[model samples]
Target chain A: MSFLSFLLGEKKTSASVAKDRLQLILINERRGSSAGPDFLPQLQQELVAVISKYVKINPDDIKVNLERQDSLEVLEVKIEMPQPEASA
Target chain B: MSFLSFLLGEKKTSASVAKDRLQLILINERRGSSAGPDFLPQLQQELVAVISKYVKINPDDIKVNLERQDSLEVLEVKIEMPQPEASA
Candidate 1:
């Protein structure tokens, strides 16, 4: 399931707000966790490198982040793949 | 971290297409599997029941979908949480 889907509720709710809310939650959930020892950036970078073989990516937006909740350890990779350019 | 985040890239891309792309990719990624057969819907409903404790949800939109990749099994969920109406 996607984050937007998580926040997206009801036919009345706009997808715009859903996008914003999901981003906030996902970021906070992921960032709030790196309180412990982690080599997450390295791992993220490597994952991006490996996955890039199958997709075109924008390096800067490829976020290698982690989230920590109680005893749970979650590693999240946000890959910003390039959009196809509009053809004139 | 999230599907939208995965498709969101560069300074020029629109969030509109990002939302759509993420939805397709996630649905396809999750639903593309489960070819053999699994009790996914039942699992989804129960999962939603458990998670809804902390969230407001629209039961109908809580899709219990699945996707299967080679040697990889993924259960994807789409939860449509309630949105606060306008203050008007």
Candidate 2:
């Protein structure tokens, strides 16, 4: 399937973008660190300390991390996770 | 390295997030397809057709993708590339 066909139904909102930006930088600082699913909460808490200077952040809605990129690493920050049960 | 400290400096505008959503969906469809750098452009071109329905998009600003996650994959779509010389 083409990228467009795949993305056509998904929606993007403004608040979510702000959240993603918040997540990316946090991931960057953690670069070259040990890998695991456990990294997220610590990342989220730290994000709160800094981002509060710019805007009120809803912690439950944040996602910050180091995502693999074809054997490389990508610093990503987002407002949400793909809903687990909903997507499957 | 906490996630927030890394993200505080980088800025994310609305356009970028929409692009990210676009890329993620496209990447999902392309799942398990291949391992190569060549896939990006073909993905980008295809994304333009689908997203244009929502807004006027500048092709130069688009990046539709399949990024990696812990040796796994994460679909991504964004408005631009990290400017090579500017960031490095």
Candidate 3:
């Protein structure tokens, strides 16, 4: 808020507070790329393998993408799972 | 955690949950740049103006930096503030 409060040693220094805020924004920008961390492919495989146990799903049915929304870095994963066969 | 729970209609779709996580990471990355948003200059000026009211501070005394640590984006602002004159 105000530096005067900081001068009185109320809580944390103004610099500390500013640093926290600035770093938060920087991290968001870095994660916004659609081609995110190298482990994404592995993550997808693991997800598909786990999800396949419950429903019939093709690997292509799963789609994962990274997006940026103002202060938010969003990961979107979509899956098209087929209905299980009707029990006789 | 598990997609089977999602199929049971517990709360949200797996896609929605994934989206939130993805976006968060992206936002952090975006904000991690040392040469951050264009508004930084204005922000520095405003901060200095506000802080100067209480103590003698030079613009250079304030340093703003953005750094990334794993999933955390840190904004560091260091300011050197002079002590105020003691009142009798």
Candidate 4:
């Protein structure tokens, strides 16, 4: 029976199976420290302080996202500033 | 003269100046390894191979992006699969 089943293709495509496996691995890694470094919040706080010195901004207005591509890691910081006054 | 200059605000707003400084810092950081892990391409290739086993797919169809938000890092993998055939 096992031999006959092997001769026939699996009900699920190999791609779907591989995707499931990869998702599991990713979830496991997320549970570990692989998600991000401990200093991220600290960095965000410091950035807020520094930027606040010059511009009046809410802490929540700054969003920092780090993306790693190949050997390079890019730090993306997006700040939502209030619109400048209409006059002057 | 310097004291008088300080008394009068500089032509550029402090906010604009701060933005320039931050941009410079970000550019410098990009020149360093903060962008991503070295294994990204390898992982992408392996994923392509694995998925190809069950489904016919182009290597470029898969895109993996790792995002670090606060203390957690999320591995996001997006695969563009070809539409299924209509026939049963």
User: Docking quality tier of candidate 1?
Assistant: incorrect
Q: Model 4 Cα displacement at B67 (Å)?
A: 29
- Looking at model 3 chain A, report the run of 10 residues with the lowest lDDT sum: A20-29
Residue-level lDDT of model 4, residues A1-88, one tens digit each, is: 2222231223644332221111111110111112333333444445445444433556566666564433223344554444433425
**Per-residue lDDT for B1-88 in model 2, tens only?**
2322332334545433322211222222222223324433454344344444433446776654565432223345554323223322
* Candidate order, lDDT descending: 1, 2, 3, 4
DockQ of each: 0.03, 0.03, 0.02, 0.02
* lDDT over C-alpha atoms for residue A35 of model 3: 38
Per model, how many backbone clashes are there? Answer: 8, 15, 35, 8
Query: How much lDDT does each candidate structure score?
Result: 0.36, 0.36, 0.35, 0.34
- Which segments of candidate 3 are over 4 A away from where they belong? A1-38, A68-73, A84-88, B1-88
Using alpha carbons, what is the TM-score of model 1? Answer: 0.33
Off by over 4 Å in 1: A1-4, A7-39, B1-88
Docking class of 2: incorrect
Docking level of model 3: incorrect
Model 1 CA lDDT for position A59: 69
Worst 10 residues of 4 chain A by lDDT: A20-29
